[model samples]
Target: MKYVDEFRDRDKAAILVREIGALAACIGRQIHIMEVCGGHTHSIFRYGVEGMLPSRIELVHGPGCPVCVLPIGRVDACLGIAEQPGVIFTTFGDAMRVPGSRKSLMQAKAEGADIRMVYSPLDALAIARANPEREVVFFGLGFETTMPSTALTILQADREDIANFSVFCNHITIVPTIRAILESPDLELDGFLGPGHVSMVIGTAPYEFIARFHRKPMVIAGFEPLDILQSIWMVLKQIKDGRAEIENQYARVVPEAGNAAALRAVAQVYELREFFEWRGLGSIEHSGVQLRAEYARFDAERKFAIPNISIADPAACQCGEVLKGLIKPWQCRLFGSACTPETPLGALMVSSEGACAAYHQYGGKVQRAETA
Candidate 1:
């Protein structure tokens, strides 16, 4: 609670909010500040940070949730491997609810597939070790934050000679996806609140393009309310001074160069894909990772012959637009009515890290208070 309580202090938050309001007043016109991480989105809504901001300043949620961005085709491929005889499919719980073209992994589990919800890739390895005969497939999903651990697990599996254990690699890079967002013509974002967790691994250097090329300021931010507040102030301060630059507010965890040993593990086990399909963002070049050639024995794609076909997102679900910050979650017709969390029609509704889900659970209460 030491770090947390200090960040959450109401008195400090009030002072920061007043400073941010003054800064926003100087900007004078409507400014769209995008928080390119789901954790920041969650913090904003949870702590009423959005409500505290000046009316002219808007916080747009970007495509940062890895599970939210995971394409349906990938889910279908996972189902194919999961349904295979004598195969054990293991994945994070959030991924099980993501709807494929036909059915979700949850549906497959109900219909008798050996599907297990695992917290980590190492858990899947343990399952493989316990059952030497059955093939254990770990459905890897996330950004750079989780990649090194999964990569390390694969290395461990290779060293231990766990013949039955393999990973269905779906790990994505944040920078490419951010580049994709910046390239979109419809998006008129002024600044960004960068992801702290991903920066902790990949570091601040990768985000220089946001300021250098795109001419938008970015503050690498932590998940805490005060961290987010200070980050907003930093971005607004950049705008006030007409300076576009990348700054780090969460430097306590994220280094300027990032973790060297973690990078080594990732380099050893994985390589960049030519292009990877995102659920909302479509295919972005070099945005995904796959098992390296040396680790071919632990590659799930090679181990199982999967039907790798693209499945289009639902017509009613405006997840793509929502992800791009074109509209709020409630603006989508299917959001609360057809796409409730209990019966989610889009990937964003299924994942807690998703902007839509965060907005639904946390946004409304604060919004109403502010509006009132």
Candidate 2:
């Protein structure tokens, strides 16, 4: 409780709030700062961080939720893998709720597909080891934070000579995605709250371009209330001083150099794809990772005959606009009325880390205020 209690203190939070307000007054214009991680977005909504800030400051939610950004077509591909006879499909709990063109993985499970909810790839490996005869496929997806474990799991499978195990790798990189956002003409971000977990794995060095070339300050932020508040203050301070630099506010957890062993493991197993599709953002160059040629034996896409089709999102769902910070979650026409956590019309409504889900769950006051 030491770090938790210390970070949540009202006195410290108020001091940071006062400092941020004082800095905002000097700038005397609207400031848009994007938080590039879904966890930070969740914290902002849960702690009512937006209400505490000056009205001039708008916290734009970027496409950081891996589950939220997973395209309908890819989910369909995952279902294609899941529906195959003798195949056991394993995925994270949030992924089960993501709607495909036809049905969700959860719906598939209900209809007798061997779909499983696993905490890690190792669990899927364990299932593969247990079954021996049936094919076990782990649905791998996310930014660099979760890649090392999946890579190491593949290494473990190789060591044990597990013939029935493979990974449906949808692993993506964060740098190119951020670069894409920065290049978009519609968004005019003043700074960024960089992803904490991904930065821990890949380090703060990769983000230098955000500050150096883009001229936008970025503070690698943590998920706690105080951590977010302080990070906001850091970004504001940088803007006040006309300094654009990458600073790590989550230094206790993330290092400037990153975890070398984790990077090594990730490099050992995966290589960048030429271009990969995202739900709303579309195809980004070098944005996704696939199992290297050497690890093709453990690659599910290679092992299975998949119908890698590209399906469009629903007509009413404005997830693409929301992801680009062009619109807020509540502004989406299908929000709350047609799309709820129980029945998600869009990927954003399915995951708790998603902007729509966080807003739906905790933005009651914000919704009423905005709608009024």
Best by lDDT: 2
**Residue pairs in candidate 2 whose N, alpha carbon or C atoms collide under 3 angstroms:** none
Worst 10 residues of 1 by lDDT: 363-372
Q: Scored by CA lDDT, what does every candidate get?
A: 0.89, 0.91
TM-score, model 2 to reference: 0.97
lDDT tens digits, residues 148-264, model 1?
999999999999999999999999999998998999999878999999999999888999999999999999999999999999999999999999998999999999899999999
Which residue pairs in candidate 1 collide? Answer: none
Q: What TM-score does each of the candidates earn?
A: 0.96, 0.97
Candidate 2 residue lDDT tens string, 1-372: 977888888899999999999999999999989999988998898888988999888888888999988988889999999999999999999899898888899999999999999999999999999999999999998999999999999999999999999999999998999999889888778999999999999999999999999999999999999999999999999999999999999999999999999999999999999998887778899999999999899999999967678887777788877877788788888888898988888878889989899988898546767776
Stretches of model 1 off by over 4 angstroms after superposition: 365-372
